[model samples]
Target: MNFRRLLAATAASVIATTGLVACSSDSADTKDTAAAAAGETITVGTTDASKKAWAAFEEEAKKAGFDIKVTNFGDYNTPNQALEAGELDTNNFQHLKFLAEYNNGNGTDLVPIVATEIVPLALFWKDHDSIDGIEGEEIAVPNDSVNLGRAINVLSQAGLLTLKEQGLITPTQLDIDEAKSKVKITPIDAAQTPAAYGEGKPAIINNSFLDRAGIDPTTSVFQDDPASEEAEPYINAFVVRAEDADNEQLHKLAQVWHTDAVQKAVAEDSKGTSVSVERTPEELQAILERLEGQLKK
Candidate 1:
């Protein structure tokens, strides 16, 4: 696979429907202890870079008798399919909206076991230094329907435009109330948003392209609040099959990723652009259900 293309896909690509093969848990173990304490091997999947950041965490899990084997994938589509097919114990790579979209689009019920950080989405002026410097001019955003809606929300929150209250989980550019907006929204491929933003053209960029574009999150003219109510749907998460919801070893794996060490590694890997957050599994499930409803509508 071309690394660059896969990298870009990893950030914003919608996965096509694929056959999922669910795997069976080993029922043959005679150990009376909890599954995690029984020296179980938990397989996980995520983007390529996650494995490196998780290497020490994996080792730590092993010390606690839960051996975690994290596999790497290049694009956003495969991991979840693998998980559904029972190839992986769990995976961490998408926000709630993406996961919900996956379930709705494919009729799968992959569920989040824990919450993770909200990746920052921001608007940067190519020439202007701040939001005030931007006029009611043409602005570029990710054209993908899901991310486009996100860009619209970020822009709306920045007081750049007004967005119609759509019942959809993720809004498209059509949801933008153009009559109440200041700038012309230009939707393009997500890979192009960084360069467009770079030229001082008003551009809303996704976090996936940040490092590749060498754009620092702190330097943006208008950045979304990770802690804000509007951002809750976008918070990333660790997901597993619904069947594994009560699996002791899988829960332990989620705990391993939620630890300070794993968080530190995430910050380091993301260059402090993203931070880890812990949300109640119930809350995450609600968000997923709500998003799923919107998609079905």
Candidate 2:
């Protein structure tokens, strides 16, 4: 099946689990009481607990009348594993594509309960200030599966490269339409992309490393559009075990990231790079399902 059809079919199958319910005030009140009575201290796992926005998020959750303990992991692989092992109640660090790959590879059923935001992948060159200046040259990309595909998409969208005419989801080096492309890609470790940029090679750098590299985010020659429909797979979200998909408290806590204070802090933390997006749980789950299908193929 095509991508949209795949998404529709997958979304339809799980609507009951992920969809929003319109309840009367009385029922909503009952749910709140029940949620309070549970008195569970939610433990949320993340890769970046030091971000000021997370502190703001915690405060907002307190205002909403629940407590959450945020735990930080040093690497990308641990958070989901912790969530799957019941060491964490939820996690908010990964996008749907990453979650899909993890689920497919690990045989886990983690699902996104609420969307956070997409941090656009950008191409930066120390010596060049414009995309046109870097034509017919090599651009470095993250070698990892999750970011390599996104880097290719960013280069393609920036008009520096071309991709094969196919239903390419998470494409690789082989998917490049080399004969029609202007630039070549060099896949490297994500952490080293900044060093590659320092050597004057154009590199698509992940947002996480920008600050440490002292690279100005706004200096990127080109970046993928986070608000675009093609970016659905890149939408970061609060993820939980499939069984907790209906946990009202977790869902509410995830939504609290959108409050004014949290949003402001998040933007500042990202150096104005993080674009806050509001997507329904159903939408996030559908994207995750579609991405998983692509991985299975």
* Per-model TM values vs. the true structure: 0.84, 0.86
Q: Which lDDT values do the candidates have, in the order given?
A: 0.73, 0.81
| Residue range 19-111, candidate 1, lDDT tens digits | 222322333131113343443456778885453467767866776677567788988999989988777778988899899889988989898
**In model 2, which regions exceed 4 Å deviation?**
1-32
lDDT of 2: 0.81
In model 2, how large is the Cα lDDT of residue 158? 82
Give the total clashing residue pairs for model 1: 5
**RMSD versus native structure for model 1:** 8.5
Error of 2 at 57 (Å): 1.0
Clashing pairs in 2: none
